[model samples]
Target: MATKRWWVLGCVVLVVAASALAVAQLRKRDFQAICDGAVRGGSLRYAIGDGGIKASDVDELDSELPFGRLSECRASAEDDSTGLTVAVGNLESSSLMSELSGHRDLTGLSGTSAPMGGGWPGVLTVKNKDIAYATVVLKCGRSAPHEGILVNVKQMLVEGEGNFSSDKRKRLKLAQSGAAIASDVSKKWECGSQLGGEVDRAPDDVAVNKPLPLSQATGTCRAMRPLAATAKKWGITRAASTGSDSRAPAQDCVLSNSKGDRVYRLSALYGPLEAGFRKSSSSLFQVSGKAGRKEKNPGWAWAGAKCPDGSDAALFTASSIEHSKENKRLIVGAEFETKMLGAFARDLGGRRGCDDPSLPTG
Candidate 1:
């Protein structure tokens, strides 16, 4: 009797373990499929605050924000520094945590009751000289009111998703640690990663402040920490200015993309920028919001005259430029637009990956 009982017990244990393993494998496959599908669909936005901005919230016909406006305006000709005229539209409450919670519907998501506090309502425009730039007309609690921060790359790309980055992991750790190192191992780990590969090599003759080429400033601009020579080979060439061209500022360096597009232009004083871009003078954007808007006109007399599409490309260019007064500070820029703009024919042909427009922002 004892031997028979032992045999039964062993069989039961094996069966339970096998069931668990099968379930785990199935779950892994499901998640992997979901992630892969999302990426291949070009639905991934490099957003920070919002997992992603949804098509429902961004479509031209849909009402995504509680308050929205659309306007056509021009930059003041007399005061060139008055900058661009902004058309504020589609001001609504968007939740970053909700989008990241894996719940596509804001109503179904947990924490809907949480307050958004003070970010200004989003705006839109179909015309402007510069790409989407936020001007903080209001303040969020005590934060700055005239600056816009690029906090939602995911929303820009995949509209309803989250960005997964190595820096984000470090940030989570720092938040949990209350700004203190829990152990020596943690400090060592961070130091090793920071100084690994490139920083360990030739420490001399590297252009610390040299601006990167704009074309290369897409989502893949790597720093020159590994090899100064390797970095030099990847910069923009035509960026060098002539002595008589005093109007064109001398660049410490220029940013370029794989296609050799000059995505960034450098100013001797402001450092690097997307040529004509001027950061939005807004306060709510200074803390935790991102936007991209712009306008462009290449002299009408040019050959091969394609009416330069200055929308997304301008935003992409603007996002790559950064500036700061402090030497060691990490400067970041965000691009914002009321709606994604491109050739209308391609947009409707499904190349734009049209989303179900039924989702509501409220």
Candidate 2:
């Protein structure tokens, strides 16, 4: 009778192990069932862990949208904590969270970012240790939505103990998994986008553009190091590249005073709203040589570059932060404006593979 009891106990342990594996597989299937396969079941499982979430993590934010063309899926825990979200929409009729707005920023992210390689013209950005986002716009034909379809993926860890909090490896895995989900859905929807290979790494902003002493500037700030002495006349003593070396469209660099306050900003606009930014900004800026004259503007200067997409990308150098120091413009900002504008344009053009851009007529 004792020997019989021991055998029964061993059998119970085996049964529990098999049951656990079955449960995991079931959860994966349910995870991808949200929104007609737009959500990849394995994506979140790969980024985080299989046991970290339940099968109920995937849900439709809105049920009214189409099954496959445009949908939104959220990965969340039962206790109201969301791990990630993916949304799709038409470029013109709807707005993707990662698209460029009228502001100088494209995604409003500053912590870290990198390209989603594998031919997809997309980018991934990490806002902090807890939040990350990915963006991809597919050039679909037939005008179903009458334009391209945009996909935006965002991951926010509100659970207070996400693996990506400080682990650089986990952060990169998050980027890759986010891109993978978007890529899968884009392809399944029949949107013919040139999606490419997997993302290898996503470097932090400081790594991408570490702030250095003004004299020891590098990357975007390196080209303008010669003008560091001139810019110092306006209290600028530090230089840093806010832009990524990656060929991502929008990029910029910042100049700061000893107090770490940004005294000047130089930016390159290459998103769909590039023209809109230039037109709207004309309200505050007189835009030297607007009518093709040799006139000049002291507050700011802008240059135009013809992008490979046949669009005009604008580059600007602005000193709004130090506007009160306008008296120094005549003494130092004039030459500084033109030189910085050129420096920024060259760096941006080279990164994007565009021919040399034209300097502002003013």
Candidate 3:
């Protein structure tokens, strides 16, 4: 009798273990499905497919289980001139929740909170003025030990008529569609724990007087002395001159490499940027300097154009603090192989801190 009882106990344990394993695998697949549907769903395609815009270059979807069974998936798509990317992930840490709460200001965005699927709440914000961008964050549900699902969607207006008022409305519509997609995905996954009430706001903590790093500015352009070697290496033997700018003083210098195939134009603008300027700046390049590409560093925001010589010219802008009371803007334009634009922008950003008094010559 005792031997028969032991055998039966072992069999029961094995059956329970197998059942748990199967459930775990199914959960993982469900998370992946949510991610895939967000990118490939017909509704998303139809939302952005209007007005001669065609979606192409849909990148491969990526999903991963990182840190304590937390699953994440991300995907991106590109249209004629605009880019869209979405990421959905299961939140597993209190620290992550705190971080999300800290960014609740929405900067320049204006929107109201709405209840999402499963009674979870979410905030949607859209920027439609001088710059066009949109963002949405949805709270799915909570799990034991305080885990949840957070969905984020970001879209950038790369190409459109410069008119912001009309463009803003169009961007808002797209943003709403994105939020709907996130809600649907949240429901499908059935994340536990409802995020109660409206979205909360934290106090702003940015230090307006923080000093900017100046290690990159080592050469002088006024006397054309310290940069002499750089100019020589690049085959730019011409003396650096202070170019003309009427609004807020600025300095400009043009140089080219020995082959004359690569040209670099550097400009520095002095004075404070207009109010709310930073808030409206597009976040498309916030992740990677290039839209539709992921990189290791937060690069300068930039745009590119094709030059007459069959080379590509790219322009980038970086903001810095000259001192406690003053702020400066640096703009660099380089003509080089399209693939080298990001590296060139980083190089220019490092060189903007020069101590030359002749910089920004009024």
Candidate 4:
């Protein structure tokens, strides 16, 4: 009898161990599924979970959360002019909870706090009579450590709206509905790795003072760091090279003022004759110049104009070289009416070359 009892006890222990192992494996698989989905841009929908709220605008706020190991997903919906934004974050419960409380105080928002069922805490705050926001931090009772979810919702009243008193009931209902949906989503939430796959190519090949390859340089404008003097004078801190083509390897460099409100583009083109050049050059002329004038540089052309905003602009184009027998032609042009256009065009022409060079220094 003792021997039989021992055999039965051992079998029971084995069964229990197997069950525990199976559960663990399932949990791991679930976490991996969330991560995979996130990287594929499915997290936007997944974050909403089973909530009946349909999101018309969904955007990934960030690949990683600001605190701890976390990821965030954002979704928004608009009814007429009113809008609601939902933001979800997956992280540690304790960390999320602390962050939410801290944020509430830091933002100077008057909020009502309450404990939610299932280890969740929520805060609701109203920003004036037209806007309201709420946050809920939830923790699943699963075996995972530091696992938590955060949901934030913000609602904006339509334009010309009065106080919330008129629609208090409706507002309360919406808030309650949002909270319930958030809780449901929290229960299904799982922390995942950084979202999105790496792009196959580098984001930008253009570098200050560094020349790009002909293939990369052609047809694409490279943004370059602006010189200090140029940046200060016209607030032009950023510059780019673009518009290279096959027929003649033509290219253009664009410069933006500090406010990024204005832009200047410079280009050089080659053709067989003046008539051939005109065919290619007319577009540049029409776009930059309504009037023309003789510039200081020999064989160079210049034009000036007043923008609708009362800002001045100018365009400069000139034939760099003329070949009679071969009928080969090279035209250089710069467009900007600011005080700095003359100097800028001269500098650009000096640096014109096929080899990608580092961005010019101030």
In every candidate, how many clashes are there?
A: 64, 6, 4, 17
Best by TM-score: 2
Candidate 3 Cα errors over 4 Å, as ranges: 1-34, 38-40, 51-79, 93-120, 125-146, 161-166, 192-362
User: Between the candidate structures 1 and 3, which one is better when assessed by TM-score?
Assistant: 3
How far is 74's C-alpha from truth in model 3 (Å)?
A: 6.4
Model 4 lDDT per residue over 1-362, tens place = 99999999999999999988887565434432222123211232222222223333343454223444333333432223444555455543223332332222211112212122122244333444566555554444556443545556565666674343234443443345345545445444542211122112111111121233212322323323333343445344554442322211122344443443223343332111111223232232222233243344322343222222232122223222233457433222333232233443334323332222122112
lDDT ranking from best to worst? 2, 4, 3, 1
Residues 66-145, model 1: lDDT tens digits: 33222111122121222122222211221221121111211111111100111111111101111112211111222323
Candidate 1 displacement at residue 40 in angstroms: 8.7
Supply candidate 1's per-residue lDDT for 350.
Answer: 22
Q: Give Cα-based local distance difference scores for all models.
A: 0.20, 0.54, 0.32, 0.35
Provide the global lDDT of candidate 2 against the true structure: 0.54
Segments of candidate 4 deviating more than 4 angstroms: 1-65, 68-79, 91-103, 106-120, 190-362
Q: Looking at candidate 2, what is the lDDT of residue 352?
A: 73
Model 4 lDDT at residue 51: 28
Which 10-residue window of candidate 1 scores lowest in summed lDDT? 298-307
Local error of candidate 2 at 342, Å?
3.3
lDDT of residue 101 for candidate 1: 16
Clashing pairs in 3: 142-192, 142-193, 217-353, 217-354
List the RMSD of every prediction in angstroms.
22.6, 6.2, 22.1, 24.3
Candidate that would win on lDDT: 2
Error of 2 at 249 (Å): 3.0
